[model samples]
Target: MTTPQKIALVTGSHKGLGYAIARKLAQQAGIQVIVTSRKEQDGFTAQQRLATEGIQVDFHPLDVTNDSSVQQVTAWAQKTYGKVDILINNAGVNPTMQAEEASLLTMQLETMLSTLATNVAAVARITQAVLPLMQAQNYGRIVNVSTEMASLATIGSDYYPLAPSYRLSKIGLNGLTVLLAKELQGTNILVNAYSPGWMKTDMGGSDAPFTADEGAETAVYLATLPEHGAQGKFFAEMRKFGGPIALTW
Candidate 1:
């Protein structure tokens, strides 16, 4: 019997690292990539852009911060694909450039809450929405896009800025990854988080050294790990280290 194509859903993939990851996954055989964005036009534009390159992918509108949007997309995936084989929680926000984000004392409470809503809480919301499909198939690969700045070990000493909200939110995401992986132990559904590093994207800025495509390498690696592969671990960008290496949590 021929193996069925895997359905891979990537949130906020219209541009930047998420787009790079979606394009790479769609280029691979036996994978049906669903590129999603909050705006329908952006999603369709991204789909068209890939089509020009002979890479076909589906598009879905997903607002990870909205419960209704999450439910609607999950329903669409279930009806269209029967199961979701891969889920990349790539939708996130970094408001570090805001003056208030420069320090914890200056950080606005609302900004912190909003960051957590999308970066941390939205991940849990969407993961909870799509996990049933993975459970049904007894297979899955979940990759949470995280930043090494969130590492508790290096947060204090790292040269990176104190962007309190972004760091705290990602720390929450990392925690969620660990707890979710523990709950999924002894199963084919693997969940891992990886720091894509500082890449040149809208979020990373032009001065950054790496490209989004380069940053996306580890996401693809973690997304397509073999059964019984590393689970519940944090990884650095494979491009930087030449291979997958677990980062200190």
Candidate 2:
């Protein structure tokens, strides 16, 4: 008998960490990877690029912040892939609120609200849409791409003002991870969050310590984990060019 193939949907996968994660997933056999982007053209191009490298990939257009777009993508996932065995919520925004702008950053409603909408709300919306499919499969792995800045254990009072919007939004995302894990307990589905660390991506910036591919390692690992894997925890890179290990919640 032929082994069944698992389907994975990775959001904001046109470039950066999301693209790397989608590529990593496609590298493994029996895993059909869906590479998504808010821009339909980007998604198509990414699929083509990966196909050139002999990867099995498909394109999907998704805008996590928009309800209609999220619903349309989720329905498309169901109709085409039948089920999304793994979900990598890798889409996020980190507005460049440099130290120079610290004083007014907090009060900047556009930056703060936009970050929350994409980083927190969209994560929940997409998960809610794909969750029933995961439940139906009785096996699912959801990896919420988070950041170390979100860690309360590490973020002292002094750190509160740094990237306030992005940090707070991730903390919110982490809460969703815990809540979802709890709701899906005693089942095969597992939900968790991990930090990809500073990588050389548009979001991470050019001076970031690592490359996008390196940063995506942990998310890929969590995406393929077994039923007994870690749940509702945050992870970060420990060793140089290594995968992520659990960090404090």
Candidate 3:
């Protein structure tokens, strides 16, 4: 029997902004949203939580840093849903504190490496694994959840503060988004990097101005972009913020 709905794969969606994104997609887009997290319990809880809201959501265990885990999830997605029409690479990490304080000698190389593995490498790997299914249908939307802290323009202007490793990884992700978009420029796949404004999530901290719901708005918007919508652009919430900063290459 043909599935009754489209499928959206959202990573790190067990709670916070990821959960909000998945919930919105399921409720607004009428699609089967796959909620993924590293822990089974977390995923299950999120699945149950969304179900109570009268939304359709499924739990999947995915550790983006683990290739085997990524492969397993990709295989499951193909078998269960046939294809994933939308992918939100929302899984990321920011282990380091202030960028100024970080140094090659003082910084934890392991942590920095792990951060890049999740924030950048996994995104490319997962996208590659899922691209074929999307290609077959010639229709797809890929939204890479990036940060404004990754903006090179802002970093160079001295207006933006640095996060060193975290900023580097996000900038790399943005570059990947651009390259992927260019490669699939003529295809139905529209790839873009979305900077969900600073929100009060575990990563964004309680001092952030936006809530998870508010922060997820941009990602949800990009996930459902129309065929003619903008692609390969860096999008932030349409609100006033600090000036531009340059990213370290």
TM-score list, all predictions? 0.98, 0.92, 0.90
| TM-score order of candidates, top first | 1, 2, 3
lDDT of 1 at 220: 89
Best by lDDT: 1
Greater lDDT among 1 and 3 belongs to 1
Where does the lowest 10-residue lDDT sum fall in candidate 3? 240-249
Give the alpha carbon lDDT tens digit for every residue of 1-249 in model 1.
Answer: 213899999999999999999999998889999999999999999999999999999998999999999999999888887889999999999999999999899999999999999999999999999998899889999999999999998987999999999999999999999999999999999999999999999999999999999999999898899989999999999987899999999
The residue-by-residue lDDT of candidate 2 on 1-249, one tens digit each, is 212678899999999999999999999878998899999899999999998988869888999988999899888888887888999999998875555326543447777788899999999999999999899879899999998788888887534447777777899999899999999888889898988878898877798878998888888888988778887777785344355578887
Candidate 3's C-alpha runs over 4 A off are 1-4, 98-105, 158-160, 238-249
**Model-by-model lDDT, in order?**
0.95, 0.85, 0.82
**TM-score of the candidate numbered 1?**
0.98
How much lDDT does candidate 1 score?
0.95
Off by over 4 Å in 2: 1-3, 98-101, 104-106, 157-161, 238-244
lDDT of 3 by residue, 1-249 (tens): 226577899999998889989988988755889999999999999999888878878878998878899889988998998888999999988865645325555666676677789899999988988888899888889989887778787766644444577878898999999999999988889898877877898887899888888777777777887887776888875443332122232
TM-score winner, 1 or 2: 1
